[model samples]
Target: MKYSARLRLLAVQTGLIASLGLGFATLAYSETILTVALAANPQMQTAAKLIGNFEKKYPDIKVRFQTLPENQLRPAVLKDVATKSGQYDVVMIGAYEVPLWAQKGWIVDLSQYAKADTAWNEGDLLRPIRNLVSYKGNLFATPFYGSSSFMFYRKDLFAKAGLTMPETPTWNQVAQFAAKLDDKKAGVSGICLRGVPGWGQNLASLTTVINTFGGRWFDQKWQPALSEPESKAAINFYVNLIRQHGQPDAAKDGWQECLQLFSQGHAAMWYDDTVFAGPVLDQAGPGVKDNVGFAMAPVKATKASGWLWAWGLSIPTTSKNRDAAWKLISWLTSQEYIKLAGEKAGWGQVPPGSRTSTYQIPEYKKAVASFGDLTLQSINSADPLRPTIEPVPYSGVQYVDIPEFEQIGDFTSQQISGAISGQVTVDEAINASQKKMTDIMQDAGYIK
Candidate 1:
């Protein structure tokens, strides 16, 4: 062969080697992005920590989170799931939607994945939260955090007012305390409660009040009971309490609004989800962290009146990347992730009320010593199966398990909000709610 021909062949081989090397580099760096829709709350901050660690571990998989307020998050995620739009790979849902969505085939059943992975330790989940996220013995979602309602008040204010909060306060006692502590001249409302009109907003807290007042949404035969004496009394009590002592524009206030009020020293007392305690204590602002005190949710006829809830992660059936989504879900809810989050965000910010292991962690226990036991007690004591004073058909502390209850509860909340705003009398609100509930139940074939 000629010298020039040999040189040409060598150059061609070198070019081919360079092209192959570039191809392999592209393959190694290829990325798969997962979109997660989350509620804008403190839990999301913990999730962000987990996601950061997850990305480091799985470099090829990127995560993007869309955080929306609770009310908006529900409709946005539900619309995507119902329409099979595949817009979100993972969605944050509550106990209320898990069973219904699983039954309707809108979300993936996580039982198989959970069972197959011994390291996942499904048994570590608290029973009530575990059962709430399961349908027909199959898990549909994994709880990121579980919660129950409790009364949070300012120790400083109570001391200044010469008041002492009981471990388990009654509604009457709460009213008395509120009256004494109400000092509007100093820019503080006596109490703050959610009044936003949504099933999961105002009604979540209000339903517990109804239950403690010996009110049931329906009778044993699934009859509408909204206008019954107990229900009416509960509604009237809630309206009057908020109207007289709650924050200004109380009817428009929900969890976030009331949280701000209490944290900013504008409200002396608040009754809502226990999850808020972490943010209230940890936030970098003029929050009443050191002076905050917690007690069981106020009761009337019942011994324990707290409502149980969990914010969980579910993969919609429309997800094109179920396996990757499941991987992210597993990582976020795993004991390992909890530890990682604790390390990164501090034990106080570690997602609580989900795993038994979290409560067992010495650091977490020490960090949340003030509210840990109380929160766990509240969660364990909540009897969703027998939420109200009287026996009812459904099983949920703050919500009825049936799908129709969402619509019914939302409608009732609107009426109650109207009453709070003085747009309608309490009697008129209760009567309208009762009529609407009757129509809904009858149309759903629950009533004769």
Candidate 2:
């Protein structure tokens, strides 16, 4: 890709023109290059095609995608933007970062970019998705993939067990159903959950579980709420469930691990990101493509509960090539990308849980069957602000939207994961989380 003259000038001002030129030259022959930080996933094919098209149109500009492991992508981008390195022209981000980064003025504001580009079709994006991708009524990011939590099960096993999952199953009901379907003697575990210890990893599912069990992380006064009776009950319930029925190495399993297990017919049920359905249904990936089943996440004492997340692209304010990044971001998120994904990778492998239009498409509907509607419903029902039945000040369902939340949530999950690993008791885990959260709250001046 060819750099704009203005970009070269801006790079000179930043004393990065030499570095940028070296970076471009270092790549396979290119005078212009856009560096993108991303997370690897199956749907990236569409973006690759769009990049190919971009190179074809702007032959002078070459886009280099530096895709990281799912967990590493965000932190790498955060470091780049936070340090004002501008190493990344485009960054993959999420709901957790959109508002926070935009509010901090670390990322470029894309409101004008969206408004001026008729071809981008901001209105054509899914409503909840578009909303989650925004901060202060301005678009800061474009969703590359969005998801809500859901249940992936085995229909054949459910039928043989003479059980049917409810439209909105409860956590208790899920436990019972999983027990029935579990065939430990045959090596199948009752349920699968993410145990990977990032705040957005296990904590995503764990927070929703906490909410459904009538728990809150903080009260209106910002005091730590993890010690509440309901929260304790929730923690005990989860710790016991995993100890009693979860797969071995429960603390090591993340989305991919659970997806692999379920697809291999080792898990009776899995509670994870709805995005997992794509690989499960892909004929080339998991061998159990035809036998997979899906439903909305189980809840308790709540109308609905599911965590919302999006893997998206945001330009850092430090970027000198905002317009060029906008071009790439717009193309990646356009309706055209979805269509291309469907045509090239099959409807089942297309990105899920972001758009209303995908479900309406006959090919996609037929490819996905009943669960497509459930995925859409799950995304729509996720109310981050009203996540739990109880009132809370946070604006995220599975996540609390504070800068400190990442550290707090991850540290807290470590405490719980220790219990699941039999290194601590459930009570000890809860008490530790309570103490740490209390300290964090006090330090943040949320408590005295």
Q: Choose the strongest candidate by lDDT.
A: 1
Tell me the deviation in Å of residue 438 in model 1: 1.7
For model 2, the stretches where C-alpha displacement exceeds 4 angstroms are 1-30, 283-287
Error of 2 at 286 (Å): 8.4
For model 1, state the Cα shift of residue 354 in Å: 0.7
Could you tell me the TM-score of candidate 1? 0.94
lDDT of 2 by residue, 372-400 (tens): 77878889898887888778877788889
Maximum-TM-score candidate: 1
Tell me the lDDT of candidate 1: 0.90
Question: Residue 142's C-alpha lDDT in candidate 1?
Answer: 90
Model 2 residue 446 CA deviation (Å) reads: 1.6
Give the TM-score comparing model 2 with the true structure, all chains together.
0.90
RMSD values for the candidates in order, in angstroms, are 2.4, 7.9
TM-score of each: 0.94, 0.90
